[model samples]
Target chain A: MITHRVSLFVAVVIACAFLLFDRAEATIFERARQAAADALSPVFEVVSGPVSAVRDFLADIQGYLAVHEENARLRMENAELLAAQAQARDLRRRNERFAALLNVQVDPTIEYATGRVVADDGGPFRRTLVVNVGNNDGIGRGQAVVDEHGLVGRIVGTGGHSARILLVTDLNSRVPVYVEPGRRRAILSGDNSDMLRLEYLESDDGLLPGYEVVTTGEGGLIPPGIPVGIVAGELNGIWRVRSQTSFDSIDFVRVLRFDFPQQIEIPPPSLPGQFIGVEVTPSDSEIITTPPATTDDEPARNESDDTNVAQPPSEEG
Target chain B: MEAGYRRGLGSRIARGPAIMVPVLVTLLCVVATVMPYGSLQGIPLAPMFPLAAIYFFVLTRPTLMTPLGIFAIGLTQDLITGGPIGLWILVYEAAFVVTSMQRVFFVGRPAGEAWLGFIFVVSLSAAIIWSLASMFYQTAIPLVPIIGQMMVTALVYPLLAWVFTFVLPEREGGA
Candidate 1:
């Protein structure tokens, strides 16, 4: 009877594991995962501080020694930036009004919480970071994270004082984006590299290299128009976005304080019963454009459909 | 007599579950999980605790790595990796099965043999994971990184094995 019970126990464990894998619904395990993260994140926070301090101490030493050359370079760049800022101010007045006329609600005000990157997942299989800002600092999950250049990632997990930023290179990273005025829709998926792969592009979208990719704000997860990356490479029919933010070079990061416009309606969360589409909810006050759905008989809208469609202003709050 | 008792207790303490496996596996996972820029960092280091533990068990005490333990480790990797659900569990299960069959080769084998066996295991482990992941995602994964990581895992294998020897007897049960 004991042997039989052990057999039953093993069988039950395996059965529960395999049976619990309901593809469509959120797994019982997802809750467990969140709980586990909550429990362990505190410990992780404690553990990571010393590691980050060591890195910072070393980096400071390096930066201190290179200060002169760096200062000279920064001076030259500052002058150029000043000149550009003047030019941008002139253009902004004309563009802002034109944007206003177009009823384009470009993101006007953005607040940021500067956070030091405490820990990084530098493994072969995953890429992520623990940032110092969390719920206490008003950092919300799904906020856009950026550095000096542009898009870094979206925050996925939040703790009391620290949050995990899922970088663009993580395997699970995906953002909805529309190519400039034409608004070609594609999913940007991260595959553990500096370059994110643009998957599920419509055939004949004419996505030439060097075209800019921006958030479409279709999903309230990210706002539109914060520079993402240029279409860096198209090899073997695969297009990749060379992220504007140097993911590898991130030291300190800023979490944008933006809320999803609560206007966009989303599908209600259904219990995990069977296979279901991920519930895509548009945060209200978020107006987003979508490509017309494809039908079998309809030839997909040509590339011209996306051409001349001006992108909306998007920056993570 | 006291010294003899102390030695016995010391070995027992060394073999304690709370001290050994968790330390090894968690250290590896934590380091690997927090490893930023594995591809860009020319250091060629990827945390290899899972490989390390599997090798230690397969070579020393195959029974230690039960299916449930392997499953748990794989599940941990899945959660940490943020990949599709059943991925790492399946790969780990496959590794566990393969390791069981190859247990004899390492018995009385030199450290070099153990090293070779680890290279074999880590290579096979990487290949299985890479190929299965491609099938799952239906996308071509860059094989070079996996291969590169596997080599690093192999290089680090000896040191970890050396560490394990301080606890797990070089000759099984010799303690």
Candidate 2:
């Protein structure tokens, strides 16, 4: 009895020490976590195989039960989409022309690697998933993960054969987004709930329920224009976003492989007085014109020229 | 003399299963709890099967499950769930200590009394885990999911305890 009590006390003390002392940013702990995930991912895959099959079977039965209503809904949606598709084609042409004229730099095409979700966080407080693709498949930290519906989450950790994704609904997740109709920028913050809280919006003007929200790509890590969710409603005087991605139905996901463009430096042109060894000899019949300078205009002209010449370096810096 | 020898051999044979069954069952429960059951994903929580198993074995065969063994089980769960390292460990150990201290009150009582005792154990374990997790994340986590999980585990305890009884050795004068 005495030994049992001693053992319990020792275990409790050690556990407390680990909780208090172990930092989340420690590389050793991260490596160990990834190693464990790598070792256990296959076991999760095997266990989840039968469970996934059963779930799919039940889903198929539900689909069959609702086939008639689903068909009617699809037919109406198809008609609407066909009309929208034509309008979209015209808009695409106009957008391309405008972009070419403006010389706007557009994002490159996104490439992705697909993987299966092998495990869930299983606990109530955290929302995460372990997928079977990892660094070997070009999955890296901060890459955006999406299902067919919309943006699901982003990769946070990876091993050789598996990776962990922090879902957008987790308390730690914060995504910069633009609310449409007014393009009001806000931070989509998760509160470990089904819906996300829209924080940091500057104004509520022109913002309404069901307004579309998309990523602004403010952070180059996530590319712009990915469909995230819509403004669902307000709760406790705070706006919320309901994610387009359904958590329960997520199985396979695509991890986007994108790299932000780097800035290139341009050398500045030499000032007129700094030119080396260029003697200007006018031809006998050629006339060189010089403007009649006014005392009031001379300094202003020189200052404006200097300002124009100095703008690039400061902007680049 | 031959009959006495046979009785001694039979007692020795019973000892191995008596110890191994509970541990194996508890480990199985740990794995099952962590498996991705998509159907249950909508519920926002999974039943704490390992906690229920530990509670049962600690009540029936307290010597079989040591603190170290319980610690390992908790660590496995924490690692698999990708939560804080020692979160479940502290929660499970606290429940074990409390249950062990109070085992005498429910040992020879009716199944109803044991079931009632288990409700208290599950509630205590959930509260400890909820508090620790909230502190770990530096936020007050929503109470609905943990409360829902507590109710689910308590409600499911009787069924699990019944299944466990099939593996347990019968008492000399059975309750």
Candidate 3:
């Protein structure tokens, strides 16, 4: 009896000591945490591989069972998507022309690499997942991760061959977003739940249920206009985001290398009789004799020339 | 003769299933945690199988399952799950100490009594873990999920306890 009590007391002391030490040298402790994760990832992979295979097999069986219903749903979705695609193409062409007219370059084009989700932070306290790609694949801190649907999260920590993603539903995640159609800006924060809380809305102006929410790129951390989710329910003045990405079965994800737009540059205006799109350089006589046609829609030659030289205002407002 | 008996007994234990069985079963419980079981609204419903195993072994065979072994199990769980470190270690060790102190009432009792005791222990364990998590994260986590996990862990205790007893039958001499 005495021995048992002594051992129990000793164990309690040791546990408390670990907690104290953890709080004292948090950096060293975090390094140890990373090391431990790196060591255990291989074991997790070996165990989860067969389990994932079984799950895939079971999902396949369930898919076959719902084949007819799924086919009908897909057919309906495909039609709508095709129509949307055609409209999107036309809008994109117009957007490009507008961009060229203003001489404002588009946001830096993002590149991506794929990775497999090998392990997850299975505890309810944290919402993080470990993927099999890391610095080797050019995945670094703050890179956005997404699936076919929408944003999952961003990279928080990286190991050599693995990286940790803070899911959008984690307590620490705060994404600046714009509520579309109205374009009201808000912060999408996670509280370790399925739904994310939308905060900091200027007045909830034009905000409603089912309003589209996308990243605003306010801090230049995430690229603007990536679809996040729609505005969801409200309780006690807290609004939620119904994320488009399915967290239950995130098997593969793309890590986007999104470099936020830094600065805007505008070129000097072309000389009269030197059309912007025309390839040929006109001779001196052609320049002297040709008339300057500055219509009302197009400002006079002097002002329009200065307008082309001036940089457009920043997109923050 | 005493020395010879001691040596023979030690060698017998080394060759026996005492160490490997409990450790392997506990390790299996750890692996069961990360298995790809379906979840409830994104929260996994897999019962805390390791907690069940720990309660059973700590109650049944305290001598074989040492405090260090318990610490290792909890630390491994914390590490793999990416939770705040020392969280499970503290919980598991506390459970170990509580069960060990109350072993007299629990040991060799009817299965129903064991299950009942497990309900109490796991509920207490869940409370400790939840409170620790809330403190660590400095926010009040919803209690619904914690309660859900506790109920599931308690419900699965009987099946896992039966497995433990079936695999390793009671010996003539006990801890």
Which prediction has the highest lDDT against the true structure?
2
Please, what are the lDDT tens digits per residue for candidate 2 over residues A1-317? 67788888888888887777543443335566677778888888898788678767876887799899989978976896798789879989999998676554455689999999888877778788889999999988888898887788888789989998888888878777778868777778787777888888868876888777887665556666788887878889899898868676578999998764433223333323222112323331223233322121011122121211112323321
List native contact recovery per candidate, as a fraction of 1. 0.15, 0.61, 0.37
Tens digits of per-residue lDDT, candidate 1, A267-286, equal: 33242221112334454223
Model 1 lDDT, full chain set: 0.62
Q: What is the lDDT of residue B73 in candidate 3?
A: 83
> Please, what's the RMSD in Å of model 2?
11.9
User: Each candidate: how many clashes?
Assistant: 25, 0, 0
Worst lDDT window (10 residues) for model 2 chain A? A294-303
Q: Please tell me which model should have the higher DockQ, number 2 or number 3.
A: 2
Task: Order the candidate numbers by DockQ, best to worst.
Answer: 2, 3, 1
Write model 1 residue lDDT over B1-175, tens digit each, in one string.
Answer: 8998688667657766733453355335544445333233422244566767766765676544566666667666555444445666666666666666677777887889878777777878888768766765457776766777777778888888777665553322463
Q: Per-residue CA lDDT of candidate 3, range A136-161, in tens?
A: 78987778899988889988767777
TM-score of each: 0.68, 0.79, 0.78
Please write out the lDDT profile of model 3 over residues B1-175, one tens digit for every residue.
Answer: 8998697578657658756566568877876776544345756566888888988887776666777778778877776666677888888887887787678897767889988888888888878988988876678876666777778889888888888886563442542
The residue ranges of model 2 lying beyond 4 angstroms of the native Cα positions read A23-28, A57-91, A104-106, A263-317, B1-21, B39-42, B165-175
TM-score for chain B of all predictions: 0.75, 0.83, 0.87
DockQ of every candidate:
0.22, 0.45, 0.38
TM-score ranking, best first: 2, 3, 1
